[model samples]
Target: MIKIALFNHKGGVGKTTLTVNIADALADLEKSVLIVDADPQCNITSFYMDESRLEELLGESGEDGSDATVWSALKPVVEGRGDVGSITPWEMRKGIHLLPGDVLMSDYEEELPTAWTECFARRQRGYSVTTALSRLVNNNAESLEVDVVLYDVGPNVGALNRVVILDCDLFITPVAADLFSLRALSTVGRSVAKWIADWQTIRSLASPADRESIFEGLPTYGGYITSAFKVHTGRSAANPHADWEKKIAPRVRDRVVSVLGAVNPDLIPNFGGNKVGGVKHFHSLAPEAQKYGFAIGKLRGYVNPGHYATVDDARSTFAALAREIVRRAGI
Candidate 1:
């Protein structure tokens, strides 16, 4: 199975929106999928549930249930016990299952120092933070019926983000067409670089060559996906570009592209390459997505052909990105 994560160190970059729609797009193609909401914001989780259900789930996301959330799912396995799958496949749609998150999930941050302590504990083999998360996903998940697992993560490099980054196989970056989000591309690249290095550092010290066998390899991030992309005619784009994307994209495709290529050329090639991967852009189908409280991709009519002809084109873009992922995973 492919475990894909949607993350950006920068906030307001449409990370959650891309995660939801991509899952829908994949489901349209009949691909079985799992979406884990690791973001304390739980925006993705609320989107998947009805009103009352959302309220209840949000209540559950508090300190009272943080342990029962995805964090608990990854706890070290007891001698004879197993991890719990908080998700019920049958209760989920035929092709999709969701592990929800919420706003009150901030306790995960408070719990990090304890985790740092555990990592240094010499408690047991694979008891490190990385292994704890690995064990959680592997143990708690009863069974996965799909080929892809998507994680909607928050914007940061703290405990959960670190663990999720280590556990994911593909990183789908969603950035606004603004400056701050674009500038964030550089931070994301650096974070990925460090993550890859650190994973190797830990793996090298292990006794067996396949010590990291329990976890997936740290693949270079999938190319960034631009959200709220307005018309590209250069006429202010009706709004030039968002503040975040403007500062970030160039650093990603320009400065870091070559270095990333040296490390994993297949993941992020030259922007205009023949490979199934390269930098690509996507805009919001409506004016609302660019401003306002909702994303156009979330609207029910979003799938209608007229509303998203670009989706057809973007699908090819992401499909290539997906192909790059499969190729790297040796699938």
Candidate 2:
């Protein structure tokens, strides 16, 4: 399976929304998809199920001594009890599965920093701790036999996210048209470069056996997706939102593509451009899709006639984005 993470160092960039709808679109294309909710906020979990169902999953352990959440699977390793345990993902749709997120996952953040330090010494326990999430994801993906695994991570450059990013085969940044999001590209670029270099050093320190056991190498830069930008009826240069889009594109090229490419040109694909796709503001249709627990295109019987066009647009937009991702990633 090709593992792709939708991430950004800045919050409110529509990462959760893109992760959900893109998975939905991929399912429509007959690809079995597994979404790993690595974010401690559990926003993607909320999108797939209601509060009562989420409570049941997170509140108590299963008969098999698991809660079927990301934290539950990694809890054993974090506490030094054992390695990651088996997790059963929830089938959100015909071809879509969700490995629900846990609010308690924030607890794992404290363990990663120490584990990362010990990795330089080639300690088995340290490697196990650091690769806990990766092992959990890979095992579950194999069991499900899914075509792709999409990760939704929180907005930060924390130690927890460092491991998550390193575990992936590729990652995409979801950005909004604003100065804050623009500036975050620099942080994302620099942090990823450092993480990849450090991971390479750690790999060099490991014995061949340890290296073989823990060797899911560095992730490459897939591309960036422009999201939550205002849609104007007319494509005029005078429009402020259009102006921001114009400005952000070159900066994305300079900050993200060039920086990562400089580190290792192979980290970026030879695709003509780095923009995978874009999503316009969905307005009320976005909330309706979330409330109904369906992609905008999948919502039926609950949407008003007035929003039909918006739904159609959203469906087509996501479908095209999914196709581009498949082509670009060679999935």
Candidate 3:
């Protein structure tokens, strides 16, 4: 299975939205796929659920051990159980399933780093999140013939994000083109680059006794995607505006590649830019809220509720994004 993390450390960059919509597009292709919402906000899960289940899932409920919490699943990886494959997916469709996120996932930001620092940490124990996720999805892919695993990570680049990216074979980044986001694009890219570098450096430093126990197989970063490039309202869509087609395209394309260029050739994630039509949807509070899973229906009552594609002139941009991912991943 081709595993990829749709991540950016900056919020408001359409990470979860891209995760849900693109995975849905892959479902349209009859590809068996699973989306693991690692974000604590759980926005991706809320979109699939109505308001009622959101309340229950987000609440501090019982620890009867029957219930599935994202936090509890991390335990098998944290201890020396070497068990990362037991968690089952919550089915959403014939081709698509989800491992829902809980608010407790936010705490992982602090826990993963500390766990990795411990001397007793095992290969699977040090990075429970990835090992478990990899094991679960890898097993499912082989047994059930699934095609992909996509992770929707929270807006942090600590050990959890590091582990997730490490395990992934591809990365489709969702980013906004604002000044802050552009800066974030560079910073996050550098962080990911350094993360891979850290793995090799640590591997070399490990004593013969500690090497196998501490470092699991090293992770690789595949290509990335930049989503939701804003369009100026007054710009002419009547024809290919020379400015947008020529001048704007190259700069935007370069922005993504520039950051990822200087890393381990095979290990550095490739950044291929893509667009989500977020600007047109931003005007209506209902559309904005629905995108974030704060509402049940479309921004315009006339728009079909289940039709959640990132529609631009009625074209599903997300489907194109999914196709691009499948092609680039060579799946």
Candidate 4:
């Protein structure tokens, strides 16, 4: 299965939105998709599920009967109970499943950092901690039979992302048209490079059996989705904020080329060449879709009257973006 992470080191870049809609779009095309919400904020999980259910599954008292969150599977390894347990994915739709995220996932961040260092010391627990997510996915792959696994990570270059990104086969960054995002492109490139190099350094010292489960080659930069842009032309494309696109797109390409080109030059050939799709400001449609608890692609007519145009734009843009990402990632 192809694993893709919807990531950006900067928040408010529509990473969660892209993750949800892309899963919907891919599922519409009959691809079995699994969205693993790795973000501790659990925004994707909150989007799919109601607050009451979240409280029940991951409450303050932690008294839930079901353990469906990704953290549940990892708790076994983290607490030295056992290996990673089988994951129970909640089916969001016919062909789409969610390995929901939990707020408590933040608690494991410290343990993961400790494990990262201890792994090189030949501690079995350290290696297990590093490979927990991969093991969880592999444990469920046969039953899930998923075609694609999508990851949603919070905006940080923390230990959590260090583990998740290692398991990813390709990464699709959701970027906003802003100066901050332009600067963030460089940070993301550098962070990913360091993570890969450090992991490889550790892997070089691992035993044959440990190496089998310790590392999956780092994911390559697949492409980018430009989101949250002000559409001055409003789909007319006469003069749609040319300066924002002109500034950010080329810089994004350069950052990726400079960071990853030495290893995977073919992933991004030139400026704007790796841009998969552009999503303009999806303002009202975003809340509307969230209110309905479904993807905008699945929104229907007459229910949300007078917003048919907005729904159409949301559906078409996300569908096209998903298609382009899948094609570019060669899934």
Go through the candidates in order and give the C-alpha RMSD of each one to the true structure: 5.8, 2.6, 5.5, 3.4
- Relative to the true structure, candidate 2 reaches a TM of 0.95
Task: Provide TM-scores for the models.
Answer: 0.70, 0.95, 0.73, 0.91
Task: Name the candidate that leads on lDDT.
Answer: 2
Tens-digit lDDT string for candidate 1 (1-331): 7778867787876667666556655665567777777787777766656668766644553332244355434332321134333433223455777776655445545554455344344333333434554554554344765667777888887766876777877666666655566666677777676666655555555446446453544665555566653223354455465434455456666644655566566655343432223333454443333332233434435455565656456555555544554554433
Judge candidate 4 at residue 211 and give its lDDT.
Answer: 86
Candidate achieving higher TM-score, 2 or 4: 2
Sorted by TM-score (best first), the order is: 2, 4, 3, 1
Q: How accurate is candidate 1 locally (lDDT)?
A: 0.56
User: In model 1, what is the error at residue 190, expressed in angstroms?
Assistant: 1.5
Across 196-313, the per-residue lDDT of candidate 4 in tens digits comes to 7778778888898888866665777877788883333345555545666887767766776568776555444443467888887867777767876788766766346677777777
lDDT of 2 by residue, 1-331 (tens): 8999988998878888888899999999999999999888999999989999998988863334685699888888888988888887999989999999988788888899999999998887889999999999899899999999998999999998999899888899887876688789999998998898899899999998888888566788888898884333345456655666787778878888888888788898877887888898988877888898989887656788888788889899999999998987789
Clashing pairs in 4: none
lDDT of 3 by residue, 246-293 (tens): 333344345444444555555444434343223223334434545554
Where does candidate 2 clash, by residue pair? none
